[model samples]
Target: MLRVAIQVKELISSNVTSALDSMSSSAKMLHQLQREIEEAIIALEGERTKTERNLKRLKATLTQNEMREADWGDKAKAAMDHDREDLARQALMAREDCREAIASGKDDIAKAKADLKEIDEAVKELEAKREETREQAKAQSAADADKSGCSDAGASTAEKRLNRVSQMEKRTEFATEDTASARTNASVDREIDEMRRASTVDAELAALKGGAKKAPAKRARKKA
Candidate 1:
């Protein structure tokens, strides 16, 4: 079986390659999106600035119109008290016109403020999205790099094989030594057995001789 190190290294390399590819794609998309976001934000800001200025101008105009309306009312009141009916009517008409202008300006200001708030919120959301994309891309790139730099298992497997062969050689040497010792002990055992057999035969022969001598002695005693 192949060593785990080799297989794992291959897997890591392949996975890292895939991860890097994905990261690259993500980065490209992020770049494009960031550009779009920036453009949109710029355009929105420009429009917002224009709208704010318009709103401010309208507000100032509205204030001036209100002041004019108040002046006209005062004039109308004075004229009415002085018995100038035509003059009072003209002032009252002018005041009504100013009121209408002020109302229109107020509406414009409100619309402009609403548009500015919406643009500001949109810009903030885009920024947040851009930040998230950046972080994700960074993490992916780091992971990919780590995977690509992984080591292969062939070297370790070769080392292990060498170690196993060395151990086997040592075991074989021990077995050879054991076999030689057993052979030496067997030769010594055989020699001791042969010597014991010869001693037994000699002892039997001596016993026979003694029996013979004793038989002769008994016969002599009977004769006497």
Candidate 2:
């Protein structure tokens, strides 16, 4: 029974940890989703702008085509008035081409409008989801922060360890400086001692020379 209880407790703990992890991951996903949605909206808006421009151009071209058809109609009437049936037939045939162009332009306009509407609807849906995800991510973040005191605790431990390492480095540097100072002092003392010994030897040599010269003078006087 005790073993079974221990196993159950471990399982519960594992489940709790897993749930927290899942929540954290979900929060991260929300951030990615928001960015993706925003980018998608931007792209969609750009495409919409392009569509509007294309539609405008198409309408302008359609107007030109209609004017062309009218011009052909006038030409046909003038040719018929002059009794030129061949010229009138050619003008009518050209007008048919202009009419076809106008029809195609109208179709393009319709498609563009439909496409823009769909894009607008998609943008709205994405924006709504973006807001929803943002709120959920915020709530999840707060909850995760509360539960994961481990992060803060770990940072604190790292800070203290760094401080300790810094102190040890300082101590080592100070010890090295002190040792260098002691070595320098010892070297200076040795040099001073050597200088003193050289001075003493010179003084002894001067005294010995004086004693020898005086002894010679005394011997000469005694001989006299």
Candidate 3:
């Protein structure tokens, strides 16, 4: 039973290895796709970095514009107090232009940030996929090697055990047959002994009867 169990375990492992190997081609394809995705994501990230830098510059410019607008507002108020309407109008226009620049910069920054986040996530996902595929391949290779080795070892062990069991069974059967044959010979010998004893007793009884009959005849003849 122990040997049989080992053989069964080996067979199962071998089959599992075969099944996994069957998927090797598919796994390679997945690995390739994962690598491609990673490369593409890397390239996209490089581009995204440039965009992010541009967005950063734009944001800095926007901040500077806001400060300039505040300065312009103060100047415009002073101009109004001094009764210079043309100077006040020019200052207000410059402030409005700064506001528009700040708004445009904010929009660009928001879009760049969103794109960067998406690219980062894609890069992370691709890395995960690549790692997963590599681990799977390694595990499968190890399993296949182990299964092949175990199957060979277990098969040999099981065959030896089976042969031993068959030998034992044959020996047992021979012993039983021999014992039965011995019993048969013993019974035949006992029957022959009984027959010989019965024959001896019958011969003795016949001789005695013959002697008595002869004596009775002789006595009759003498009396006559």
Candidate 4:
């Protein structure tokens, strides 16, 4: 049972660490973690039920032993009253055996109680961690939503800027001959600036994608 508890603890720890590290898949990971914890709890409850039944049996046995010991004592007294030394000696020996059995039963009951306590503690810890994981998953989902909203807002702003630049270029193309050369040069400069901005954005996006890919690969290696 102790070994089983330790294994559950290790599994919980690993799941939590992996979920935290893999933000993109945190929801799935946390869901899996919750299932594992529930399974562990079920297993512990089963063990607890068995231990409780055994404890009850042990107490019943102890009670019967005590009653038998009392019966032997009564027989021993009756034998003495009748002046039967051999019968009295046998009764006394039977009482001693009952006493030994009572002692062993009490010890067994005590150990069963200890085992139940340990199982209860493990169940409690798993429940608490399960709740904590749920909260973390909620927080991660909110963070992802915020990130997506920010990205959409940025793309919208970039689209509006590009539209304005396109309008300016159209106006320049329709300019009179007197200012046509100057407008053309200005349009070329604007185009160059736009290309530079687009290139920079693409490079940054590619780098972000590379980092995202590396994170999972690194996690896979660690898991292996």
Candidate 5:
């Protein structure tokens, strides 16, 4: 009976370890996915900028072509007034070419605008999905931590103790980082003091070299 109990305990420990590992992998994957989504949104914004510039250029060209078509019609009318059929015919034909260019430019602009709209919608959807994923990952982590209960086939006492220790270690590591940050701030103040001394020394030397009046000496505090 003792041997059978030991075997069952070992099996439960193995299963618990496996489940914890799977949960860890899921958490890591979710974190990586969140980062990738942020990068994709940045890239989408860059593409949007390029597309906007292209749209602006297309619209500018379309405007120029439209003006040219109007000028061609006036030229054709003037030629006919001077009884020059050949010139009038050429002007009318050139106007058709301008019309074609304007049509093509408008079409390109329309497609680019549509692409921008679609990209905007995609960004919004992705941001929403990323937020949802963040919430889900948080809930899953909490649930995994909460699901520790009395099951005869569940994790053994040793396994639960190890998990608790692991969590405590993580919290302790965060505390260590806070201590390190405090040390960094103290060092920064020392560095600032050194900078002030160095600057005063440099200013004194510069004054002597330039034949300027010497700065007043700072009086040391007397012990009262």
Candidate 6:
């Protein structure tokens, strides 16, 4: 039973370490860890029950031994009353054996009680650690969700900006082309310059969107 308790302690420690290092797969890891802790608790409880039953049996045996010791003592007195020294000696020896047996039985009961205590302590520790791990998993899940939300919001903003730049570029092209036939050389040069400026703005917006698309991947790698 003590060995089982030690094994459970080690399992809990290992589970805690795993929980701490978990990231995207934390939910799955925590679920498995929870099952392990519960199994350990069940095992500890089984040991506790067996120890309790053994302790009860030991106490019952000790009680019977005490009664037998008393009976032997009475028999010895009766033999002395009948003037039989040999029978009295035999009765006294039987009572001594019962006394020895009672001492041994008491020791066994004490050891069983200690074993039960240790098992109970192990169960409590496992339960507490399980709860702590659950809390950690919840916090991790919330953090992951928050991060995903931010990433999505950034991507949405980037897409909207890109769309607005595309629309503006299209409008500028259509307007310039419509007025092309009526424009002089100077006017045409100004239109070309305007188109160049619009292209630069479009390129900048595209770069922003590209960076936004890569941001989530970078965060994921860092988390890993």
lDDT of 2 by residue, 69-178 (tens): 89987887666555565676677667767876888889999988887787677667667755765677688677767673546565464455334322311222322457
lDDT of 4 at 107: 94
Q: What is the C-alpha RMSD of each candidate to the true structure, in Å?
A: 58.4, 46.8, 56.7, 39.0, 29.6, 44.2
Q: Which stretch of 10 consecutive residues in model 1 shows the poorest summed lDDT? A: 1-10
Model 5 Cα lDDT, one tens digit per residue, 1-224: 12222322332334223433453324434454455456556767777898899999999999999999999878866665555656766776677678778888989999899978876876776677568556666766666677654454333543553443233112223224577678869988878856764564355334333432222222223322
How much is 38 displaced in model 1, in angstroms?
A: 1.2
- Over 111-143, each residue of candidate 6 has an lDDT whose tens digit, in order, gives 898888778777888888888767776776676
lDDT of 3 at 52: 77
Task: Note the Cα lDDT for every prediction shown.
Answer: 0.57, 0.61, 0.55, 0.67, 0.59, 0.66
Q: Pick the candidate with the highest TM-score.
A: 6
Which of candidates 4 and 6 is the stronger one according to lDDT? Answer: 4
In model 3, which residue pairs have backbone atoms overlapping below 3 Å? none
Task: Give the alpha carbon lDDT tens digit for every residue of 74-143 in model 1.
Answer: 8876665555656766676677678768888888888888877776766676566546556666775565
Candidate 3 lDDT tens digits, 117-153: 7656655654565565566656655655665343456
**What order do you get sorting by lDDT, best first?**
4, 6, 2, 5, 1, 3
Question: In terms of TM-score, how similar is model 2 to the real structure?
Answer: 0.54
> Which TM-score value belongs to model 4?
0.54
Query: lDDT value for candidate 1?
Result: 0.57
How far out, in Å, is residue 56 in model 4? 1.9
Task: Supply the global lDDT for candidate 2.
Answer: 0.61
Q: Is candidate 2 or candidate 5 better by TM-score?
A: 2
- Tens-digit lDDT track of model 4 for 1-224: 55456546555555445544554543445565666677778888888998999999999999999999999878866665555556766776677678778988999999999999888888888888778777876886676666644455644644553343223122222224558678769978878866765564455444444555576678899999
